[model samples]
Target: MDNRNMSDIIESYLKEILDQKNQIEIRRSEMADLFNCVPSQINYVINTRFTIHKGYKVESKRGGGGYIRILKINLLTSNDYLETMSEVIESDLTESEAHAILEQLYGNNLISAREFRLLVTIFDTKNLSTCEDLNKLRSQMMMGLLERLAYEELE
Candidate 1:
């Protein structure tokens, strides 16, 4: 199987468990053995698929009896979620970072898929003039969009 498929399978499995438990702790070796993949593959999935931007907190210990813990953060309010997204934007926003934020917002039902796709297209910095500071521009644009959405939610 391709690495992407493996990552998707692992991510889905973890999300399923997390949905029930809200948190989970597991050993990397055990997950590797179960998936018939290298330990590093598990790390790859965890690092990319489960990130703070996606509303997950991951902690790990390294040793013979080490464990990796994944926690699903519950943002009780839209303001809290917006604050987290602001932190993710922190000073600059690359195309990929903007895409990640849109994906997270869409996944959390904060924005529609149509809105997500629109934002993704609009944030494409390649088409813009090289003289423009894409990172700073994108950061400002994303923050404006997110703030508008948050305000809409309140009203």
Candidate 2:
């Protein structure tokens, strides 16, 4: 029931797709041979993990020349948005600066309305203690969070 290996395989395959600029064409048989698994294993991984919920687009063909294409989904203008987010996190950001960045994502339709609200609420100034060093902590935390978001597990 754990299916850890299955999950790991799926994650690794997803990473390969992402690393190759979100474009890949591999035959099911070739992939199965490489993984030392059956073709259905490949199909199962694709069906479960490469879903839109996780921000990917998948297409496939059937016949003598069948292939699969996996595209990484970006919420439009994502590159520019990520660059700006990196800048804001790198520099000294006041409460207004943080708020503005979140607002921009909300306005651009990058983040859902609920997610935007939750993010704003979690990073609220009211939650921090007077003696706690918020600026330094926020900068460190932001970088770590960004790294986690940016890096994907390899297949």
Candidate topping TM-score? 1
Candidate 2 regions exceeding 4 Å error are 1-4, 78-155
Cα lDDT tens digits for candidate 1, 50-153: 88767788999999989999998776876778877876676688787788888878887888889888888888886545736888888898889888887887
Across 91-142, the per-residue lDDT of candidate 2 in tens digits comes to: 3445555566566557666567998888777556775447277766556655
- Clashing residue pairs found in predicted model 2: 12-154, 12-155
Q: How large an RMSD does model 2 have?
A: 14.2
Error of 2 at 117 (Å): 9.9
Relative to the true structure, candidate 1 reaches a TM of 0.79
**What TM-scores do the predictions have?**
0.79, 0.47
